[model samples]
Target chain A: MQPLPKELLIEASGGDIGAFEKIYRATSDYVYTIALKVTGNRADAEEVAQDVFLKVFRKLGKFRFESSFTTWLYRITVNNAINASRKSTRRRSGQVEFNDNIEVADGRDRTREAIEKEQNEARVRSMLETLNPDQRACIVLREIEGMRYEEIAEVLQVNLNTVRSRLRRARETLCSRAQQERSIQ
Target chain B: MKCTEARELLASDFLDGELDKDARGEVVKHLDACDGCRRFEEAVRRAAVDPLRNAPRETAPPSLWLKVRLGIEHEQERGVRAALYRVWRSFHVPWTAYAAASATAAVIIAIAVLREPLTVPGSTRASLTDTEGLHEYIEEQFSILAYQDTNGTGNGANGNGADSVNFGTLLEEYLM
Candidate 1:
């Protein structure tokens, strides 16, 4: 995703409430999606999104515009999501609350397609839970966010080789788990 | 490339298109020759893509924006409170330390003042006697001075009075 223009960021940094609101509206979904994938739970994802934006708001002035705001936001979101995921794991004993009430409106009066979509999403969320937080983050960023390995390295603050190895191991684990599920099916 | 090497490359760098042309060619050739490697590659591809494509792009709930706004407000509130708290603490800590030190010094001074007389080695009654003896010695010295003055001057009024009052009688009278 493209970063917001410098002028808007400057305005927001200058404490313009409207400018910050626009920034939030522009980026909250992206942040939420990442948080959801990494955390694999809606509630935790929401909390993570809340934390990321709050950090952004608090630290907006410190942003030097040296890097794209999206990259900076990604770093914040991923780190907070990882921490939130760990806390949620410990708190819930690995029990993800798959609350079905937060369904996306498909405009089909909740038809089969909507049900299938919900099921697919639930399955994907469960699959994401199989990997550790780091691996899940790597895979989510690489596959879902379509970030390059180098970019993932930058956001994850790891070396390129580490990103490669993490992606490889994460894929291996995920593939093996998929195969197991397939065979079971 | 051997199947092992190609599988490693295929899983990550190859899938990511990060492998160089030559490495890519070798992995491709291996995949072409080895059905197992091809299936593994396919499985990895599926594993990477299927779930991601199916996983919905969740919109931030409507309440999320409200929550974030409230969070920012709360953060601002906290920022103000924290600034005020720091200011309070900055002044409070030193004053508290000074007050504590002053109290300690006062206690020490009081302890020293109150303890000095009690800490003396002699008994209280003996010290009273010593005070009485000092008073008696001072009275005797005064009496001798008065007697010398009267006798040396040959003043009968004073001489007679001094002669009439002996040291013992004078001391007894003073005591009485």
Candidate 2:
């Protein structure tokens, strides 16, 4: 993600809507992406994104320019996504919410590449769903976002060892799941 | 390093490129020596890390911005309404009426207290708070007494003659 101008942040913190819009436009893709990846659902991602921006707007005034804005944003986004994911998880009683079989609109072109991409997406979602929320968060941050372990620790407000262990355990689960799927195939 | 330790490193720091030079060297050496650890590393990459790393980036829908904007505007309106409500509530307490009533009551009490001296018919109590006035008042009371004693009657020139007769009989009457 590109870094936002400090001036824009200042203006937005002072209640400038135009500056805030720019900030949103610049950061919303990654924010939404992070939310979607963590929650494994578009609807939940949308909700989390909306919540994150609102919270940012409300608390922007108190934001001391100490840390990178994206880091702060990642923290809020991940926390909200994790909570939403957990709620949906509980709502469905352990059933994963990422439905690979949902009907796509017929008007869209159904190319072979598109189908493969969709399948790959579904596979990734299934693999992610095997982990608990914390492990999933670590995987998404470390794997998807390519955030360093230290940055993940900062974002998740956990220690480096904790990030390491979560990633280790998460990948272990994924490797095992991959092996199991291969054997079944 | 054992297979377990090397595989753990592969799962975490090795794959993530967080390992230091010395530790990474040890893990690489272990992977080179052990087939199981090398396969585990490849599996970890194929299964977990690579899929996510290569997953296509998605943009937020255009509608998301609209929703966020509407939410922000709604929240601002709600905040303004809440602030206005606080101000309205403050004024709604009838503080003006309360303060007016309080001031009126205080004035009435003050007037009633102050007017008592005027109603006493030559009452010296207000002035008696002054030392000179108190001395003059006591002297006048004594003169009135002396007159009544000489006249051998309760009637004195000051027309407090009745008061003079009863004045010294009780300490309360004397002070009055």
Candidate 3:
């Protein structure tokens, strides 16, 4: 359940620790989950989420109240996630290892639909893992988070056309690789 | 739109499509016949839906969150320290320049004050003085100007010969 005391955000901005704790409690899950998906590492994702929240706290004085606090929060979360993923890639290679003989880790195949769906999901994830962080971010925001192109542009601090291009390229790569994987399987 | 264009539209232009019946029929017709395009559509569906629709959503562990929060706190402290150092550095600059200027001025003023006594142009001392005394006086003035130019301002009473110039020249020589 979401909280209703919108005044808490204002108090938090004014350096009230208790108010900030409330804001944190209200929004931590949304921030952390997005960071985790983008970074694919708990350590990196948590760091990113923490940085995002800290920045939100520190820079809260600059907030205009022109946009919804939620949208501003979303922007902070997405930017940190993207930054975390970039750092992770530099520190450790994030390339997907395509193992043709890989078994399902879950080890459950109850029905044909279930088996196909599992296989498809695994293949998609592995292929997604191969993508550069930006493409992975775009895929996550557009397909997973269901964010619109304009919203994505705002989060990324990019143009609408760049978002569109990245989306097309990500989809094309995922689809092409997925097709090849399925044919091989 | 043509069948080829229709595939691109279906790719995700479908999300934006308030396509009327005619365009919908055209897209359906193309899909029914084009195996390549239909497979492409399925691929799109699979990619868009699989991880988002099927995979379990994972959240960060509590301990991990604590670690990150701690790291950010440390970073904030460091950032504040760095900002303070930068401000200190900015304050540091002018004081150094002032000290250098003070030291230079002091040296120049010492040279001017400690300067050799000039013979009054028409004094009984000059009448009594010989050629060697006048030559020594000129050499002494040379040494004083060199010292003041290197060290401080050489403004003084004996307004002639090598060392005699304005305050501006004294500063310029100091600069040079």
Candidate 4:
């Protein structure tokens, strides 16, 4: 993604609503995608996304443009999603139930594709659930978001070695689990 | 590198291209010589990619922007209310202090004004005795006292009213 315009960031920091709206339009999807992957549920993702943006709005004035806006946003998104995921877990106590009323077009092929897509999404979410929040975040950033190890470390506010260890452990667990499932099948 | 070290690198650093030059050379040399390390590398790569490739890219709901906008509005309102509360609190202490001081001053002024009635002599209180009325009242009281004394209406025969009047006249004269 391209960096946000400096003029727009300055204007937004000065309370220009129009400029802030433009900034939101540019980055909201990026924010939402991260939140969705981290939280693994649409409602929780949306809530996390809202909180991230609200925090961004409140703290924009303090941004000194030292890092790219996307990097700053990534940090905020990851932290908020982690917190939201933990809170959602505590609130639901491992018994999260999602509404299954997805709207689908009327056709057999379309219905099959939707079902496959939903199954794939559920499988991915379950795979992510095996790791702790920190490991999950590092894996999601590295694998899904395609961020570098250094970038992941910066966003997670940890050392590079920590990022490496977390990713290694996460991948090892996932590999063993996948093999186990394959053998079971 | 040992097979164990190569396997550990394959899990993350080798796949991610994060291994240092020397480490990468060592792991690559081991992978080339060991079938198990190659298989392990492939397995780890697959494991890392499978879930990420399958995970759907969900766009936020269309109403998400509206929700965010509403959230910003609510936050701004809360900020304004907080600021106003702070301003009110800042003034509250001084306003309370001023009110207490004003009440004390009013009490003092009231006491000073009311003290005149208590300190006035009884003869002076009976008439608005400025100058002429004061002189005439004093002379009339003295005459009444002398007449009562000469008539031998001494303490046994005279009523308490006459005794009181004489006493009042003497007290007023002494005060003057």
Kindly report the TM-score of the first chain in candidate 4. 0.88
Residue pairs with clashing backbones, model 2: none
**Which window of 10 residues has the lowest lDDT sum in candidate 1 chain B?**
B119-128
For model 2, residues A25-57, the per-residue Cα lDDT tens digits are 999999998898788778788999999999999
Alpha-carbon local distance difference test for all models: 0.81, 0.85, 0.68, 0.80
Error of 2 at A71 (Å): 1.0
Residue B135, model 3: Cα distance from true site in angstroms:
58
Q: Model 2 residue B125 lDDT?
A: 55
Error of 1 at A110 (Å): 2.9
The positional error of residue A32 in candidate 2, measured at the CA in angstroms, is 0.7
Model 3 native-contact share? 0.37
**What is candidate 2's lDDT per residue for B1-176, written digit by digit as tens?**
88877877888999999999999999988878888878778888898888899998888999999999999999999999999999999878577889999999999999999865432248655564567767777898899767776664543234444434543345645564
**Candidate 3: residue B119 lDDT (0-100):** 61
Residue ranges of candidate 1 with Cα displaced over 4 Å: A90-109, B81-176
Candidate 4 residue runs with Cα over 4 Å from true position: A90-110, B20-26, B53-56, B89-101, B104-127, B130-176
Candidate 1 structure quality by residue, lDDT tens digits, B1-176: 78888888888999988988988888888888999999988898897666775566678999998898898888788989999999988777567888999999999999988765432244333332366755766687688767655664222233365445333455654762
Superposition error at B62 for model 3 (Å): 0.9
Model 3's C-alpha root-mean-square deviation from the true structure amounts to: 17.6
lDDT of 3 by residue, B1-176 (tens): 46668666666545334357887778888888888888777778776545564555555466754654575568668978999999998778677889999999999999997675556675444632467766767787799888766555556524454455445565765874
TM-score, candidate 3, chain B alone: 0.36
Q: Per-prediction fnat values?
A: 0.78, 0.88, 0.37, 0.72
Computed on C-alphas against the true complex, the DockQ of each candidate is 0.46, 0.58, 0.19, 0.47
The CAPRI classification for model 1 reads as acceptable
Per-candidate TM-score against the hidden true structure: 0.71, 0.75, 0.59, 0.75
How well does candidate 4 reproduce the true complex, by DockQ? 0.47
